[model samples]
Target: MSPDRGDRRAVTAGFGALLSRYRTKTWLGGAVVAGLTVSAAMALRLALSPVAHFYYLPVMPAIMTTALLGRRSSVGLAIVLAIIGCELVVRRDSIADTLANAALFIVVAWAVAEACFRLRAALDAAQTMARDMARRELLLDSILTSTPIITLDCDGRTRRVTQGAAALLGVAPNGALNQPFETLLPGFGAAALQAAQRSDGASRTLWRASRRPNGDAALLTVAAHQLPDDADPEHTVLTLTDQSQAEAARRRERELNDRLSSVWRLNSMGEMAATLAHELNQPLSAAAVYLHTGQADLARIGPVAQPTLRTLDLAKAQLLRAGDIIRRMREMISNGSRAFTEERAAQMIRDLEPVVALIGQDTGVVIRIQTDDEDDHVLADRIQLQQALTNLIRNAVDAVIDRDDGQVTVTGRALGAEGYEISVRDNGPGIAEAQMDHIFHPMISTKTGGMGLGLSVTRSIVESHGSALAVSRPQGGGACFTFRLSRPTESEIP
Candidate 1:
C-alpha cells in the first residue's frame, strides 16, 4: 500500500478504537443532546419568522450541540439545520441573496463546531486526571489501613480525631471524628498530648499503654510529627510501634551476661587456690622448724635459760605468721561471702605490718605505712579489706625489688564527707602504657612466673565492698593503686 493510504488507515483504526471505548450510556446521552440541538434550532427559526432580520438564533444551539456531541456529530447536525432553515424561511427572490444567507449559516455552524471540539478535548483531559487521582487516593488508603503501625491524625485546634485514628483507639469510626484526642486515648495523658502538640518538629517518646482494661501493658515507641507553621490550626501526626518484645529480649540478655560473669569469677578463684597453697608453705615450714627447735632447747637447758626463751618466742612468732596466712586463704576461698563491719583504716593497715615486713625482708624492699587521719573508718569486710591491701603491697614490693632504693608506701586518708581513701604506691618503674588497659584482666602479667590474679582479685574484693579500685602513675615516678570506701555512720565510728 502507499504511505499516505497506510497513514490514513492507522488514523481511522485509532479513531474507531477510541469510539468503541466509550460505554452505551455515553452514546445515548450524545444522541439525545444532538436531537435537542436540532429541535431548538428549528423552533428558534420559526419563532423569528415575523422578525425583520434574525440570523444568529440557530448559532447558540449549534455551539451547545458541538460541545456535547463532539466535532463529527455536531458538524452533521449543523449541515441539516442550515438546509431546513434556508428552505423554510429565506426568500428566493434573488439567487445571490439566498446563496449569501446559506453561506453565512454554514460559516457560523463550522466556527461553533471548532470551538466545541477544543472545549471537549480540555474536558476529556480533566476527566482523565480526576480518574488517576481517585485511583491514587484508593491505593494510599489501602496502604494506611493494612499497615501494622497505629497511625493517628488530630485536628490542631479542636484536637478531634479522624476515622483512621479511631480504628486504632477502639472507638466508633465516626463517633471519634469530633471528639477530643484525650477522650479517644484516655490512657495517654493530657500533659503528654499537649507537649507533643507544642513540639516544634518530630518528637519521640516511649509510652506504656494497656491494650485492655485490667491487663498488662505494652511499651510503645511513639513518634509525633508537627505540621508546617503555615498550616491552619497546626496538626500533628502520631505513629506507635510496640517495643515490649525488644525490651524483654534485652533483659534476658543482661541476665545471661551476669551468669557468665559469675562463672568466670569461680574459675579465677579455683586458679588462685594453688598459688595460695604455695604461699602458705613457707610460713608453715618455718613454724614447724621453730617448734622443733624450741622443744629441743626446753629438753636441754630448761625454760629459764635465755636461749630457751628466745626459741619459744621465735616459735610463737612463726605460729602467728602461719595463722595469718590461713586467715588470708580463708578470705580468698569465701569470695565475698563474708559479712561486713565498721573497721578502723589504721588498724587494718597495722594488721598487715607482719606480712609487709616478711615480703620486704624476702624481696629486699622497704615497706612503710602512713595514716593522715587516725579516726578514719570504713564499712567493709575486715578480712577481705586486709587481703586487698596485702595484695597491693605485695605487688608494689615486687615491682621495686630490683631497685637499690626500692620503697613501697601504704597511705590511708579521709576523703570527702563520708569516705576514706587507701593507696599503695611503689617508687619503681610505673606500669607500661601498653599494659594499662588489661592490667586487671585474668592471666595478664608483667612479672615472670606471675599468675596475674592479684590485681583482679584485689579489685573484686574492693568492688564487693561497694568501691572501685583505680590505678594511676604518681607524679614522683611509680605506680599507685587506690580505692575509696564509704565511711561508717557516726554512731558506728570508733
Candidate 2:
C-alpha cells in the first residue's frame, strides 16, 4: 500500500518538474495549438455563415486546453485566434453586432483560461508538498529502526517498534506491533506502563531484568516520555538501553589499567632496588675480603681454632649468596633472565608453599594452595619461575597481614595443552588509580621504610617467559597478581 502511494506521488512530482524549465517549448506549444484551433473554427464558421450567426462558440475549448498546458501566455494566443476569425467572417450589415460579440468571447475565454491555469499551479504545489512529507517520513523510519525505542498506546499495546527492538525481542517489526505489554515483555505490568505514560518525558523510569524470547538474559534501563497535551493520553515513548555493553567495557578498562600499572610498578621498583644494591655492594664485598684474610691468617698460624675458622668460612658464603640475589634483582632492568628449562608446574607451586607459609606464619594469615592434580609440563627457568611466584605470594601475604581474617590464595591451573596460569590473591585494600601512575615511577616504592627488590626480580622472571605479570583489584576488596607460563611443543622440546 505504501509503495503504490509513493509511486503515485513520484509520477505527480515528475509531471510538474518536467514542464517547469524556462525554455522555448511552452511558447511553441501555445503557437501550434492556436493555429490549429483557429483553422478548425474558420471551417465551422464558413459552413454556418449562410445559416446562422455563431461568433465565438466554436473556440472556447481551444482556449481552456491551451491555458492548461501553457498558462497565461497560451490564453492570449487563443484570444488572438478568435479575433482573426471574427474579422475574416463578419459581414458589413453585422459589423457592430460582430464587434460586440467578439468582445464578449475574449472576456469569457480569459476567465475559463484563468481557472484552468490556477488548477495546474495548485496541482504542482500540492505534489511538491507531498514529496517533502514523504522524505521526512522516510528519515523517521530510519531513526526508529536503528534506535532501541518504542511507542505504546493507551490500551497498553505497542504502537511502534524500532528495528533494534524487534531483533532484541526476536520478532519482526510488524509482528511486534499491537502486542500487549505483557506479551512483548513478560512480567511487565499495566500499572507500570500507565505510570510511565502519565509521566512527562523521562521523569519516570524502571530497571528490568528478564530473559529474552530467545532465552538469553537482558539488562535494560527503561525510561518513558509522553508529550504535553498529547492527543492520545496513553501514547508514550520508551527507551530500552541495553547495559551489558557498558559493563563489558568497564571490565575491559579495569584489565587494561591493571596490566599497565603492573608494568609501571616493576620498572620503578627495579631502579630504586639497583640504587640500594649499589650502596650495599661495596661494603659487603669489603667485609668478605676481610673475613677471607682472617681465615687465611689463622690457617697459616700453625694451630687453627676450628670453630673460629668455620665461622669465617660460613660468613663468606652468606655474603656470596646475598650478592647473587642482588644480581638477580638487577635482571629486571638488564633483561638478564635466561636459562630456560622444562619444569613441572604443580611441583614448583608445592616447593614454593613452604616459603610463602613462613612469611605469613607469624603474621597469622591463612595460606591456601591450589594445584592441579595433573601437573602441567611448562618450559621455564625453574629458579626464575620460583622467584616470580614467591614474590607474588609474598606481596599477597603482606597486603592482608594486618587483618584478623587475612587470607591469601595461591593457585596453579593447566591451560589446556598450552601450560599453566598461576595467580596469587589476598583479601586487602586494592591499588588505586592515582597509585597506578607512581607504580613505574623510579624511586616510588609502596613500602614506607625502604625499597624492595622482590617485585623487580619477579617482573624480570615473568617477562623472560614471554608474558607480563598483571595485577587487578576485585570489587570485593582484594589484589590479584596473575601470569601465564607456556610449555614447548613436542618439536621444540629437548
> Candidate 2 residues 92-161, lDDT tens each?
4677877776778878988888887787687679667777887998998887778888788777788888
Model 2, residue pairs in steric clash: 264-439, 264-440, 265-439
Superposed Cα deviation of residue 204, candidate 2 (Å) = 11
**Model 2: per-residue Cα lDDT at residue 492:** 51
lDDT of each: 0.68, 0.73
Q: lDDT per residue, candidate 1, 1-494, as tens digits?
A: 45797666555455544543541235455555556666677677777768755655654675555454544654566566656655666667787877776777667766767776766565556556555656897997776655423324444223434444434444555565545555545456556766766674333675655353335466665556665654435365566555679889999899778658756875776667646766776777777777777677677775567676675665576576556556666655666355668888878788777667878889889899998666576887777788788889889988898899999999999876768889999999999888888789766679899877889889988998889999999899999999998977776444
Q: Model 1, stretches more than 4 Å misplaced?
A: 1-265, 268-344, 361-366, 376-382, 401-406, 414-420, 428-438, 441-450, 484-494
TM-score of 1: 0.44
After best superposition, candidate 2 residue 192: deviation in angstroms?
A: 8.1
The global Cα lDDT (0 to 1) of model 2 is 0.73
Question: For model 1, what is the C-alpha lDDT against the true structure?
Answer: 0.68
